[model samples]
Target: MKIRLLSGGVEVRGILLAAVVALGLSATTAAFACEGGSCVNGLAYEAFGPAPGTGSPLLAVFVHGDVSAGGPADYMYSYARQFAASRENVVAIALLRPGYYDRAGKRSDGSDNGRRDTFQSSSNRAVSGAIRELRRMYKARAVVALGHSGGAGTLGVIAGADPGLINGLVLASCPCDVPAWRASRGRGGGYASQSPVDYLSGIPRGTPIVAVTGSSDDNTHPELASNYVAKAQALGLNARLQLVGGGHGFSSGVGGAAVSALGGMAR
Candidate 1:
């Protein structure tokens, strides 16, 4: 469960080790959310950390893919818990995509939110809005954005829109180049303009990004992840590509890679 940073220096390895230790020692968990008025954009989410006014906290938001198979919240919670454990001043959030869990811990009927753009601008906007709302709610000084599978695409949109919003990003099993993937599926109706690859040039230079995928993954294709790292680096972003042994879902390496990236943000 190690990540070989593509363009990172020797210190990256040490940072990752320290991140692992930090996460191993964390034991605090308390649910949190926006109080009083309705939540931003009516998005549903779960959060863990010290009470909002108790202390300033580093923010980490984890986004999950489709919910057809269920357990999106539980799956993301596992990673969030690990992240929360690593930093005493950190708050971890698991943002459930629209129509998955549109309210606090409540699953929806799996209906589309009446958008023609599907996973295009509409989906991206929703994710970006969630991040913005979370930041506003917590007044976090730093943010680490993480996503898996389809959620990775959403994070890409957020990064491209405003790289400064998150200090670091971790994308696992990302189908960033949507057009190419759609073409491979023998489909003609895909949003080329909304793909993550299309927005790489828009990310702020020097923004830290880590793209990870499994060596055995065919869903997003490991090459896609590598391609994202290459393109981001070409655009002058601090990016890394990690390919671990597994499939399309989150693997142990994915968590380690994210923790390492978050650790790097402090340096």
Candidate 2:
């Protein structure tokens, strides 16, 4: 696996829980005009297994981190595809953050703010909106979101501010403390983005959250996630930190850890 620096993207009930563990999925994408908050279907995604409203119990959403301006901005395809392939009753969607385009050239609406001033409210709102729309579309019993790098930062905020939208969260190599990260990057004033740690009070205590970081990752260091998880625990949230062998990019270790979290949610 090619490891890059961290950067950084669904449902169901009792019957659905059974569906997620047993596993077979049918490829599906039932199109519809859906809106979440004010984004108004501004996001785009690649879906796998069971069309919307299929009664799938589990919905997993994958959001990739900041990729430079180029091809493969939506690089979570393999991860989402494999996730869907492993479960029959689950639907996985690899979402494109605002202003990002997939390999096939499908672009999501909304501004990426040059893709640097990201994880801001607008970006966070759009992502939360996308997840809301996806959940409604899938009629899922539970929703799990897996985000990496900048994507993880976004999900972290959503997991707090819009806590009701997701049941489980997997954050990989997250810059959970945005202000501190900006300070380290020499941006003394900090960007307009909202840090995940600032919004932790809103997350419910029962929500399952996990932050995974590479043991040797120089970028978005392990302490970022570890500290965030620690604070979360202080707030009585079910959160933990997982350290694995690798540099700063997504790996099979991160994927397995995330899938394991999803399984735990099912129970």
Candidate 3:
């Protein structure tokens, strides 16, 4: 894992820095369409398997964690690409969340502003907008959302506001309970508004969902995924929790787990 201090002054380590470099290096691939300034709602994105607007079986969008140094889309590029290659006619996209990849100095629909709401409706709107645009552009028959860590919080907001918008979800190492997690971290008053657990009932029932976490993850405990999946299942949602090896960060088997889970989603 090569660590690099990004030009923005954030110390980025591991495959994230490599993924960032991949974005710049793989500009000629099918996934690199947005590198020429083609962005949706000011968000930077890369596509794989098939180009958007050409039609495909599904559009699987991967959203990464809230990291200051690397783009939100950086960490999941390989996973997205691998998944795309495994399936026929699947369009994989890695979308950079607001403030992370400001293409041509354009902020992603008010996302760059520090005052932007974290997990509020505004944040959800930003993510949802990107997904919808990509979905429309690709003419995909179905949509799958893959979110990691804080991105899972954004996924929660999207699921809560528009349950039917996406067909499947993969939330990995999520801080399922924002309030509880915040309180545990000694942050009083907790951002309960951003918690995924709070929006359980809003997610459309039977939406194919897979929530996985590292068995030894201390950042976001494995119990968070277990408890959240329990609640989701109790609500008649097709949700399950899987404990994998490793810690808060990505493990060796996470990509395979995600690909297997997503491959099961109906097209």
Give me the candidate number with maximum lDDT: 2
What stretches of model 2 exceed 4 Å from their correct place?
1-40
- lDDT (Cα, tens digit) per residue for candidate 2, span 107-151: 677666777867889889999988988888888888888998889
Task: Report how far off residue 167 is in candidate 2 (Å).
Answer: 0.3
lDDT value for candidate 2?
0.78
Model 3, span 1-267: residue lDDT tens: 767687898876687667777877775343333334557865677678976566566888888776644443376778788888888889888877665553333234444334222555666677888888778888889898888877777886687677778889988878788766666666777242477888888888778889878777877788778888898888898899888887777544555575677778836
For model 1, how does the per-residue alpha-carbon lDDT over 144-171 read when each residue is reduced to its tens digit? Answer: 8888877788888778876688778888
What are the RMSD figures for all models against the true structure?
20.2, 17.2, 11.8
Better candidate number, 2 or 3, judged by TM-score: 2
Q: How close is candidate 3 to the true structure, as a TM-score?
A: 0.77
Error of 1 at 41 (Å): 2.6
> Total backbone clashes of model 3?
2
lDDT of each: 0.70, 0.78, 0.72
Q: TM-score for every candidate vs. truth?
A: 0.76, 0.81, 0.77
Q: Worst 10-residue stretch by lDDT in candidate 1?
A: 27-36
